[model samples]
Target: MKIIVSADIGNSETKMITRYDGVEGSECFHQPSVIRKLIKSPQIAETNLKKNVINLDENLIAHITSSALNRHSDGLYVIGKKAMQTDLNKVQNMNIKLGNKHKHDIPVIMILAMIARTVVKDEFELNGALESSYQIDCDFVSAIPASEFTFEKAKEFEKRLTKGDHTVVIHLGDKKVMVGINFKKAKITQEGIPAIFAMVYDNEENDDRKVSLLDKFNEVYDEEMEPNDLLKMKIFHVDIGDGTTEYIYTNGVNPVIDACDGERRGVGHATEDAVIMLNEMLQGSFKSSRQSFMEIIKDKTHNLHSEAFNALEAAKGTQANEILEDTFEKIQNKAGNSVDLITVYGGGSIQFREHLEESLRDYAETINSKLLWVPEELAVNLNVRGLDILNRTVFSKNKK
Candidate 1:
């Protein structure tokens, strides 16, 4: 059985979805985009939990479901939730851009390995088939930020990914498994702004609804009818992420290469600001981390200390206003008059939806343009899902 995998490796999170013969399966995985080295302790190294261990050379690594742990000659490494619990200091944030030269870096290799392992597991579950040797062929579709989507950069990414076959050993649940994936082919594209494609594509799937959403959008925005007509429309697409906010203005279906912009401000920046405020409220008495604070913020049932909660709410409000203000100013300066449609997506869209909507109202009124805010749950996965749809509808046809 052949497997097609579409992966989005964002700064803060990694998401993946797998399919076979153009049909999506039940298998999907999401994890924090963090990796850390596990310091070797004589106690851990000497202990033998044979069933829960993955042996790599002379080192033995414990496999925990919530984290990624692997043993190497230098030391054992942990990733995902496990790394956060083990040692926040060891956790490395993989938010920087990696060019052709850094393909062999530990983080890059580990991410690739993780993707391969996910695909293998999905293949087994979906097809009820596994090769005796646990080897499989993969057609990978992935995306990078719009600012780095140049021909040279895209090629560099592709080259690094398709360098050769890769093998990795991982412990999932109680099983020790080794997976080898051969990159039969790979296609990488710019993602941030192009995520608008997913909203358009989803509209096409739900055409039976009372109002054809895209049709109404086109009527209001002066966009062309066909999906491929995206090239002819003027679009200002904004993707607010955890670590960065990227916006691009396109004169046609393709992005206006020079108009792409990315800033370091995002939902994460706001969260950090809030955490600082929370820490200050406690008189620096309680040490707080981003993860811990986020748990409180997200969990409606979690009882927050009154003073800390008030501080957090104030910081979030300030941060949201600032981000929207900055983003609006950039849009006004860049494509305020020329843009026909404004599209917004990504994690920040949901986090600061009220502020964004309120701010966007002014822009829409000023420009008389249509505004498309992708649904909250769909926002984060827009790019990867769009890649999957593009593969099935466009690239596959071209291959024939």
Candidate 2:
């Protein structure tokens, strides 16, 4: 069966969903947007394991191991969780860019390969197929930040991704499975705020017989509204990722591109502020590691069991509020009036939800905007979900 895959390659994580015969299948799969170069180990050479490593013509790769979660690797580099476990100094968070040019960076290639590997593995497992070399035809849909979403930029991304076939070998349990993927087509959508807007607005001009992502999101979120009415509602979409916070306005139907803007202030900024506050409170007693600090900051329920840590959380909360306040003010300045609905999504939405809500409360009366936080469980996958819907509806129709 031909499969369609939609991926949202965010700076913090990559979320993907797969579809078979135009029907969504399987739960979303996600991995950290991190990669690390492997330091050669003597044991590997002694075991003659070098031949097993899958070379991508790049310096790094997504490490596949015996774990069902694919979190281990014996390659020259590692991606995702395995990469995170490596020396913090060696692991680097990928910096995804929003521009009109293609980036041939190692992280980007690793992510693409990772997505393909994941789908191929799942398909094989479901079919109870033995481990062997197999070829699959796939159509891919992915997204970039909305601020740089243009025809030229989308074409550039598609060009990069479809230049040639890619092969990925993943070790699952004791079996080694090799997958050769031939991309039949690729669609690139604008992520961040615009993608969220697209998630809510169903375009009648596209295909009239299909349910859109907006329909799915509304159903999941328990929102009852007609598509026509939803299209008329003015919305301000706030997409807070690890590296950037994008602000976009939609007239319920189409994006108000001129009113869109982005800032580098996001969860990362708040985390840094929190770390600084904690260090000050502990008087240098609390040494912060990027990995540990990020975990604590992102997971709201993490118990650090220290007064300084609690105080640090509070400081981060306050900083998060400040960032949102600044963002709102900037949007108001450019748009003249606050929107009727303010929707928030992206990884940072869950991390900083309370602070964002608190900050919005301060301006609730003046802004007269209702907050709509994408359900916590679905926040990270919102963009890709929308892209998937677009692929099934618009792209599928175009292909026909």
Which candidate wins on lDDT?
A: 2
Quote the positional error of residue 306 for candidate 1 in Å. 5.9
lDDT of 2 at 59: 17
Task: Point out where model 2 deviates above 4 Å.
Answer: 22-24, 39-75, 96-107, 147-150, 173-175, 193-228, 273-292, 296-322, 362-364
For residue 316, what is the lDDT in candidate 2? 59
In the range 338-380, model 1's lDDT, one tens digit per residue, is 7766777887788777767757856777777667676665677
Model 1 ranges off by over 4 Å: 21-26, 40-76, 95-110, 123-133, 204-232, 285-292, 303-312, 317-322, 394-400
Summarize candidate 2's per-residue lDDT along 251-365 as a digit string, tens digits.
8656677787666656666555666777777687666444457766556676654553575567657658666776668667866775777777887887777767656645644
lDDT of 2: 0.60
Query: How does each model score on TM-score?
Result: 0.75, 0.74
Model 2 steric clash pairs: 199-214
lDDT of each: 0.60, 0.60
